[model samples]
Target: MHAFTVIRTYLRLGLLNFVQYRADFFLGVVNAAIQFAIQLLAISIVFNQTDSLKGWSRADLIVLVGVHAIVSGILGTVFSPSIGAFLESIRLGTFDFLLTKPVDAQLLASVQSVAPQSLTSLLAGIVIIVYGLQTGSGFPGFGSVVIFVGLLIAGLMMVYSFMMVLASLAFWFVKLDNIMNIFNTMFGNAGTWPITIFPGWLRVTLTFIIPIAFAVTIPAQALIGSLTLANALLTAALAVLFVAASRWFWLFAVKHYTGASA
Candidate 1:
């Protein structure tokens, strides 16, 4: 309960800070709009060439785009900013202050910063998802909606765990901006399509090594009605495993963290 309260307080402060800078919020909206437009144009051009890309219809692909936006929005809104701040703090030797807090260091570090402006993508993604559902496959039933939400949560969990593992690398490699860039490049370009379109070996790598396929593709399958019970089970299992492993890795990194004093 205390943790939840602290999270809420941090979120409120973040939102308040975002609103304080009206110009920044508008810039964020404009940036997000331009990016969203380009993605739509690309999707349209792809459909112009072929009716279906690897068995996924244009509408289905639209949902995939929305999923990507939503996932990206969430990352930007909280995790990305927080991770960036954490890394900066570590570099500046200010992370010692965070470690001294009564709360869990991981929890505090994860929610320390927020970018409410990034929510533009999240809201826009919802609009795109609704439009896609209207155009293709119709609306999923209540059960499917429940399942999709579950899978979406699972997808977010996997992505967060992956990022955390990467962030943990900062304990040794303090300058790791390139790592986040690599994830963004791969996820942004590849997550727009069905993972099935990839070659077998690459698919295995994305699903297990990088684990991005589980982040965007699997939950998308749930929404499009292609997700099977077995796949859902696998997603749940992997989510647990990723989270646990990331936590362990984080602790190991902390053990070696030699604070600002060092």
Candidate 2:
């Protein structure tokens, strides 16, 4: 309940900030629309050459695109902004204020900033997902839907954990802003496509090294009814493992930042 109140307060403040800078809202929408157009155009070009790419039809690919868009939206709206601010605060020597606060510093750092404008991508993703459902093999079964939602949540948790771990590195390296770009590049470039398209080694890298498969591919596969039980179990386990590891790492980083002993 306390966490909920704090999150609600942060969201309300974010909304007010958005209201104050309405131009950002328009720009964010325009940017998301342009990105969606580019993605759709790429999918069209790919489908023009062949009926399917690795057994995924045009509609199935669009669903994958939608899932990527939603993941991007969540990153933009929540993780990216918060982590960026946290890093900036560390560099500017303002993070001490947060450490001195009564709340959990990690939680505060992770949720203090919210970019409401990126929600446009989420809406666009939803529209694309719905369109794919209508044009594809119709709605998946209830069980598949349930599995998809569960995996989607797990995927998001994995992403948040990954970002938190990256952000925690700022305690040791304050100039690590470019490290965040690594995730952005991988997610924007490779995350939209099916993992099967890659070679066996690259598939393993994406699935375990960076875990983009859990972040986008696995959930999309669940929705499309092609997700294997083993992959699903792996994703769930990774999600839990990453979250716990991130939390522990955050505490360790904070201790180091404060000059605490082991």
Candidate 3:
């Protein structure tokens, strides 16, 4: 209950901030629309060359793109913004204030900044997902829907863990903003497509090294009723492992930052 209240407070503050910049909100909406349009255009172009890419039908690919949009929206609205602020605070020596607070520093840093505007992408993603469902295989079974939601949550946790691990590097490399950029570049360029289409080695790289498959592709598979139980369990396990590891790394980085440990 206490944690919920704290999160609600942060969200309210973000809402207030968002209300103060209405124009930026509209601009963000426009930007999200344009981006989604481009993605659809690209998909059209690809389908023009072939009926289906690999084993993914057009509808399946659309769902994949929708999942990608939602993930990107969440990142932009919450994780990315807060991590950027956290990095800047570290550089400006302001992060010490967060450490002194009664709340968890990681929680505080993660939720301090929220881009409400980026939710446009989230809404667009939902619309796209619904369209895909209508045109593709119709609505999935209730069991499948449950599994899809669970996998989506697990995928989100994995992505958050990855971002947190990267952001924690700020303690050691204060000017490592570009590290996040590399992730953005990879996600923007390759995350929208199904990983199965990639070559064998590149598939392995995206799956393990960057883990985009777990973040976007696996969840899409869940929705399409193609996710194997073994792979779903593996993804869940990986999410748990990544979260634990990232938390440990964050503590270690904080200790190093505060000169408490070598």
Candidate that scores best on lDDT? 1
What is the alpha-carbon RMSD of candidate 3 to the true structure?
Answer: 2.0
| Error in Å for residue 34 of model 3 | 0.7
Q: Please rank every candidate by TM-score, starting with the best.
A: 1, 3, 2
TM-score of 3: 0.95
* Tens-digit per-residue lDDT, 130-208, candidate 1: 8888999898888988888888888888888999999999999998999888987988788777888899999998888
lDDT comparing candidate 2 with the true structure: 0.87
10 residues in a row with least lDDT, candidate 2: 253-262
TM-score per candidate: 0.97, 0.94, 0.95
lDDT for every model? 0.88, 0.87, 0.87
Q: What's the true lDDT of residue 50 in model 1?
A: 96
Poorest stretch of ten by lDDT in candidate 3? 253-262
Q: Which ten residues in a row have the lowest lDDT in candidate 1?
A: 209-218
Tell me the spans in candidate 3 whose CA falls farther than 4 Å from its real position: 259-262
